[model samples]
Target chain A: MGKRSFNILDVTLRDGSHAVKHSFTEEQVRQVARGLDQAGVRYFEVSHGDGLGGSSLQYGLSAVDEMKLIEAAVDECEQAEVSVLLLPGIGVKEDLEDAVKAGAKMVRVATHVTEADVARQQIELGRNLGLKTIGFLMMAHMAPVDKLIEQAKLFESYGAEVVYVTDSAGALMPHEVKERVSALKDHLSCEVGFHGHNNLSLAMANTIAAVEAGAAYVDGSLRCLGAGSGNTQTEVMAAVFERLGYQTGIDLYKVMDVANDVVAKIMPRPQEITGSSLIMGYSGVYSSFLLHTHDAAKKFGVDERSILIELGKMQAVGGQEDLIYEVAADISKRNKALV
Target chain B: MGKRSFNILDVTLRDGSHAVKHSFTEEQVRQVARGLDQAGVRYFEVSHGDGLGGSSLQYGLSAVDEMKLIEAAVDECEQAEVSVLLLPGIGVKEDLEDAVKAGAKMVRVATHVTEADVARQQIELGRNLGLKTIGFLMMAHMAPVDKLIEQAKLFESYGAEVVYVTDSAGALMPHEVKERVSALKDHLSCEVGFHGHNNLSLAMANTIAAVEAGAAYVDGSLRCLGAGSGNTQTEVMAAVFERLGYQTGIDLYKVMDVANDVVAKIMPRPQEITGSSLIMGYSGVYSSFLLHTHDAAKKFGVDERSILIELGKMQAVGGQEDLIYEVAADISKRNKALV
Candidate 1:
């Protein structure tokens, strides 16, 4: 096979913040960003776990101001370009400007897979601010390939530099990834990326399938410390791309060191396919609901899987973490009556 | 896509033995087998971590005699056919007969991917013994597609019922799995199978690729309780297959119960891609060597990743556990001198 090349967007500080309850110290961000920069990872995502303006009661507050974290990451990363995530509903134009002012060089405007229409203004604002704009289609597995293409076209029309098929629930199969990515690649002029979760242990494989189907940017986290079973592990993906004869440009050993040293220390818990995580993937619930569901399940004395399955049945998406408590309480009451 | 039907061979007992140091008690085997049998898994593999006669010094000894475990599993399983692994060098004809006496209805003859010739006698013996014979190609990622097809043909010539692309290191990409499984399916007249590990967190994705490429038999373990990052979780595969509109025959909720209740209790550790396990897949070392390498590294006070990388450099295949000690000692001595 000829050497295939792609860009890797490390989302450790952004997505991984959820796992640590968004309590990443500025020093933690600096250490990881510095290590990743030295390792030649060109794109680094740093923001609140839920994106700009996401530090609130429902989403859980960041221990440190996210701007401080982003600024620290930007200052420490000499070669790597800092990026921030912004969900259109959760963030506004001012928040986007604030992120840019904090030295974020790129901004990913995210929306639910079918809600790309809301992302148009955010994408436009990001471009107007002179930051590279990416359209992130979260919960890509919920929509079919044709719908994904339609969404990608919206992002393209809005001047987004890249569009992603983000498997937020980690529910996608390799064939599903292939179909969606190939569709987006064919329909959109901009680059197509894939972000994967490991709730079902298919993150790396799905990411590989995405790359094979012509994904231009793939997201990973060092040690897979993102949400639920976490994201596609950064070091593992580097090794995989290297083995597949891909020009990743990043040094594999250096990334592995970052994962082992800096990322390992900051991890709240090792990412594993726990019962709640497995249920999240199995039920197609959002991966970010893991900790909230676990806490509610424990508090209500209900099985976390039951809460996850109920949440999946309701088709709960991101920013609906309150549903976790409601579902767990209902399930606990039902179980108590049975007892 | 049309609905595709496939067989699931649950290897929770065989491959999972390594995780428990091959110490699966008779009751544990019986419980898991009964649950799986009730869940409609047609094939069950129960053996020592290595094979029939694998309870020796080189391989860890089982706490209970494997025959007792096999007999217990065999007696409890109502519908599922019991199978045993027989590595050519590790197991002899008498061991095969003993497994048959213990009520094993099938036998998988395994060899290194490049060493299929060693498996010919075992396959022939299994056929003559009136058992359903399977040819297991271990460490399949070590060989190229053409070499794997060449080796698989040898198994077919020896009258094997099915040939499996067993990813012993969990190192295969979905495309590679597609190439190998598709090749075997096209070249061999008999059925093809794929067994995956989760070291690269690609077990489910690789399995999906194998099925898409026309593999008829796929293997999984409950809760992924096997070597390294463990085998593909059985319940997860069932859920995935069901969602993809495939006829898996196994009950999804029933298997989930088995995973949550029985298999969860038996696991020594939940399988996640640990640093050493990641090195095993990155280095393409044997998945089963994870525990042995960790033990040697700890004993020698060397980093397990270094030992794993060195072993991978040596291209150590399964049954080469002794080399782990030698390499770890050398690495420890080198680090000491440098210090």
Candidate 2:
């Protein structure tokens, strides 16, 4: 109710580069680094270009060597401290030490709720080395609020500097975000962060919801790139924080310039809220929207065209594809072939 | 808090058509209508298909011949009763009556908050004719909350069946939608409907936010059609509602079929979330997102590729170009280019 306050942690090069095919040339990274640092972004999540845990031979984490990526961050980025993200079980203790030594200002450990202890162990190590540490619950929406609180408690005990609320499936609305964040805020001493997907088109809204509900930081990609619909957009949420009367410490326009000059050249333009994402949104399904919509189409014996229109509507009614089956079943009951 | 109620008003045809050039051949309308009707939508907002009123003859009212579009609705649409949208000060009462008589079950009058009273007179006329009516406070974001509520009450007194929280600029966040709808509901007798744009990429989230705040109906287009970022997609909102344990009568997959095959071919897809809209959004200046984003790009630009890329991030930021300008200004002040 009073002036809302929050921090903006931008993972554009790490996550946003996903929008650009996870392939930032050193030149491209340098260009975006200049803009992102100047933009006032407080944190730059310097990912290994590939997803974490997996060997460099794997797609995402493998795409960019962790050392090279960290070195780039260490050398080129300033103002916005460099934070490297790692999935638990993906990296060993040695990997963690090497990562930080390579110049990462911080390391965030990601894992499922059940694996919080495993993540906690690593966070403690990161902390002992004077590295700020964060813990990420990959699917915060799926994890019960209590489980999240409990897991975060353990992470905090293990010296996690921050813990995140992640809407992995893009399934949450703002109210849910508020309710969840409010609940989580009470249980953690460390800053609470948020990572959201745009599958249901709530990335910025949910991120803002988290901020307003007392999340200390919100995570965003340059162009919303990561997994399916990608992560919350850094520049967008930064604006939301600014408007709510809080300083996001980022220049959103400069970020957008990077999206134009560098990001687009690398990745396919973000898929707009297409029929599939929309349908998955309505279906109440928490699956990858692109994949689920395609699956639902085949399951229904309906053409992709038919599914596309339905996908948008389905997005609003999201649940599980089971709901899609239910809606389709209801429609089929009313009229066979629907034509 | 009490069962979390929300409405699913379907405006797939009216707004979605904007994406398709407002050119729904009779067959396309019929196809969409049949699919929508069976989808369980609460209301069908069918356009007069006429080009817009006022200045842009081609875009609004002039786009469609009212009688012809109605005839199409009567013939093609049977499931949902029609809510014909009319912009006040652009057209007259004659068209309203004509629309109702031609089989439009209801009429919606749209105008800015200051112009709300002008719209009330027409809604009054529609009510007098035993027609259901709604008063839309368009660009509600631009209108201060307290002022808009008073305006909403005026329509309620005039027998307006519904008072819509129209985020014409897609500027409102989920929390704002909750606050606005809650405020309006406290004062109004009629049901509250939510119309949204995707300029800030919060259309679905804001729509659901309205629902969570106890709004009875959620308004949106087919594929997030209409102005910038497009309207909330009917399919998307329906899916969101379904996920939240409510109902939005829409066939998710079936809707997609028509959207991809017929709608996509008809109207060129709108490239949403542009720089101007972003500047406008950040400035808290709500303008026409559709017109500002794609249309402007088509007309003039520094460069097409750069403008389009800028547009998406701008939308991602919710039309907050002022922040962008500020960011750019800050960078310039520092004697540095963003990227």
Candidate 3:
């Protein structure tokens, strides 16, 4: 195997939005973007955690307009290219156009692993607009290697420059990640990337496995400031990459300072594997289901873990959050009967 | 390779003593010990964080007599056998004898990787006292494969039933752990065990790697309650082992309940990879140096990371904690001169 070069995409402004309930102010975006840019990071993703136009009643509202946050990050970045994430149903073409107007140079069009066709229009539009178009298959672990390759190929055919195997549930083990990433590398014409969550405390290890299996682009957030237990921590990933003999072009000391000084201040709490999050990972449930599961568990008087495990058994996907209530109510009813 | 059967040793009452400042009351020990025993964990280690007789002004005093805590654990446990750790310099033979009287069925004689000779007397005494003698080589990352084998051989020759490749610093990556554990497994006659810390957030991954490399006995603390980001979490490790097809003989839900209901209440704070602890793992410094580094940094007005890095460069061992202050003072003096 040849040595593979990897790019670190700082997702603190994008995926991290979920951890903070989409409450990043424009100034916070500017601070994190500027610090990461100065620390030699080449890519900064800025958007609502769900995607562009994701701020609404259903998915928590953004504190500041996401367009303005994008503009702030784009303005603060001197060397880094700003990126935006867009899921087809959550974010529309207008949101992508506005993001481009706000100076986003790349757009990662995200869809469920088996639903790549929904993102075709956005991938084509991103290519036409001269932005770096990347296909992001969320919950990639839900599909087998062949299915992942088939979906990734669809993205490449739709003009995506890169394709990512996204572990939204943080459920895939290191060997599983390697197998998926290697399959994509073998089958996809476009560059392969990986986005990992730390719900199972394997984000760093899974990212390493992806890189070793030929992933060229990977995602991280400062201090793991994403959803659930958050993404792979950006500063620690840089340090680990350096130790692993990967040239990430990130200044280790500068990134560490940014994580500790800038990002740590705005974080509501340190990202950790709480019981709910651990159960989410163990049950292979969606990362965003954490709060919903907790709420349903409380409202229905059921254990949050039982709800998550039931969802996993049902093979629930990202958009199936309504099932949380169903699962909780069902568990509560069963327990009452037992009593 | 054939199927591997692994045993998890819950160290919540032993290494976790460090995270709580040796403050486990007798009742708390009984609760955790009984819960784990009921959950089918076969081994429970109870002692001061530093080892037997380690409670002192230097290592911090135990909240209750360790002998009583051991007795409490022994009294509560129906299936699990209580174990105690004895570092030769901190815990002498008399302490081992007392621990045996308190119903400790096993004694892990700990010494630095290069100083296993110091633990020979303790190992022999434990064996003679009808205890299962295990040799614990702490800070094993500081030595190469040959040195580790040489030291582990000393323990086997001293009548140890098992030898451990202990990552006390939490510095070794998964591949590095695989190398060390495989080396020990290949060279040693006795069974090999692994003890890990989560300083770099790789405890779970490193422990997995050790198991893959043929380690049979592994250590974990409930909720990762130990020094410097704590050890591999016992509940989480059991979950992962189940996923990996390893029969750990641990009931997952029961262990999770023990962690959440019994152990979580006693945790002062969640074990996390703080900036100081992250730097410790990155710099390969001792896990116990976190508090001292923070104190020295505050006193001398130096960055804790700098002190840790300097200590890593000097290859400082466990007993050389005074160097924390010395390094801090040197950095402070140099900074002042430049100013």
Candidate 4:
């Protein structure tokens, strides 16, 4: 086997914010950042779970300003670069500038898979600021291979340094991941990456598939601390990559220590594939919809699975949270009529 | 895209016995069996975790006699066949006869990957008793593909109906599993099967790889209720098989209900890849070595990871429980000398 080399982008502070409801304190961010930096992590993402400017009532307010959190991580890291995730509509030009000022050296401009055109301006802005710019195509499973290739090419044309097949719903099988990532690697000149969630317990496998298909960069979090069933566990990924003869440049023992001693302590609950999250993957709904669907289900006294299934049928994507309530209400109304 | 079909042999009562310390009560057995049978599970294995006659001072004692538990499952199941696992030395010819008398219609004669010859007598005995005989090559990761094929061929020649590439250590990667199972499928006349452990978090992926490589029978436990981090979750496998266009003959909703309603409640703790278990997978130690290693580590005041790594270096396989203590004591003595 070839000694394949790749980069590990740790997203614990950014994507993990959703697990803690965007309430990561400065000290916690600094501790995790410092630990991962010592473990030889090359890139560390820090932001609101939904990205910059995502701390409002709907997305849940941040305990500390994301700029402060990013600065905290930046102050702790010696070798690792701090990064941020910026969804197109939620995070505007000023937010990107502010993130760069807070010492974020990379920015992943994320968009719904079908709407890569919306990320063009932000991708160019990130490059202008001299940040390593990446275009993240979220919910990559919903689109066909050709559509993904087209979107990835758009990212490459916009001067993005890398494009990712982000399995936002954790709905993809390994072969599907291979097909989509292989197509992007073939069609685009920029490096390809993959971001995975564990809603269906396939995050590690899908990330392995992405690497096998020539992904140059991949996303993981300490203890799998992300949305839904969380992202792939960073330490486990480091161990597996080492076993597979991939050059991740990560100290496996150090990463494992960080995961156990630092990140595991702060987690509210161990991230397992719960019934709602499993339904999310099975139905192709967005990962972040988990909490909202639970609340809606409880309020309407309806099953969460029904709400998720209806949303899946409607082909819901991220930021379409209002549909959760609508689906729940409809189910509740039908239940009352039956009664 | 082809609609491939495979048999899902539920081993919750057998392998899951390890998680519960061989303490499955008769009622619990009946409940799980009835639930899975109602959900259309084709085969249900019931025995001590280490197979028949495994309950002793060395291996934890069974809460109830396994024969009684097997009879309980047999009574509850209407369509699902009751199966039992029998390791040749631990379970002699008499245990197979007893299992058959207790209504077990199938028996998997298990052995170390290099010791398949030991199962020849038990395999023949199972056939004579009108049992669906399966030859289980435990720790198949320790052997090369050609070696695995040769051993599987021996099982086929001995009249075993199926031969399994059993990853008792949870050590094989997806590609490795594919190679071994594909080789057996090509060379053997009998059906090929796969049994996976989730110590490395690759059970589902490895099982999928095995199925892709022409395995006709696959093993899973409800809610991943087996050894180490557990086996592949049965309900999740059913959902994934459905998503991958594979015919599992399982009702997805029914299986999910059984997992959530029946199995989850009985589990002492949720089976996530813990630190010790992760080391087991990383070091290629047997999955069942988890609790024994933990006990040895505590008694010797040594690190569990060190014990597991030493075991891996020695290439320890199943039924090597004594080695865990030996490794732990050696590390303890070395530490004392340094002090």
**DockQ score of the complex predicted as candidate 2:** 0.31
* iRMSD, all candidates: 2.1, 3.8, 1.5, 1.2
lDDT of 3 by residue, B1-339 (tens): 436798899899999998899999999999999899999999989999889899999889999999999999999988899999998888888898999899999999988889998887888898899999999998888998899999999999999999999898888899999999999888888999999998777898999999999998999988888988899988888778777888898987889898988888888887766677778788988766778989999999998888888999899987799988999999999999999
TM, chain A, every candidate? 0.90, 0.80, 0.93, 0.92
Instruction: Give the residue spans of candidate 3 off by over 4 A.
Output: A1-3, A287-307, A318-339, B287-304, B318-339
DockQ of each: 0.42, 0.31, 0.54, 0.52
Candidate 2 lDDT over residue span B209-257, tens digit each:
7877778777866666565557776665655665666755466666666
Q: How do these models rank on lDDT, best leading?
A: 4, 3, 1, 2
Q: Any idea what lDDT model 2 has?
A: 0.66
Residue B115 CA displacement from its true place in model 4, Å = 1.1
Candidate 2 chain A weakest ten by summed lDDT: A280-289
Give all candidate RMSDs, comma-separated. Answer: 4.8, 7.1, 2.9, 3.5
- Please list the residue runs of candidate 2 whose C-alpha ends up more than 4 Å from where it truly belongs after superposition: A1-5, A48-50, A53-66, A92-98, A173-176, A274-339, B1-6, B20-23, B48-66, B251-267, B286-339
- How many residue pairs clash in model 4? 0
Q: What's the ranking of the predictions by DockQ, best on top?
A: 3, 4, 1, 2
Least accurate 10 contiguous residues by lDDT in model 2 chain B: B48-57
Query: How good is the docking of model 1, as DockQ?
Result: 0.42
- The TM-score values for the models, in the order shown, are 0.86, 0.79, 0.93, 0.91
The top-ranked prediction according to DockQ is 3
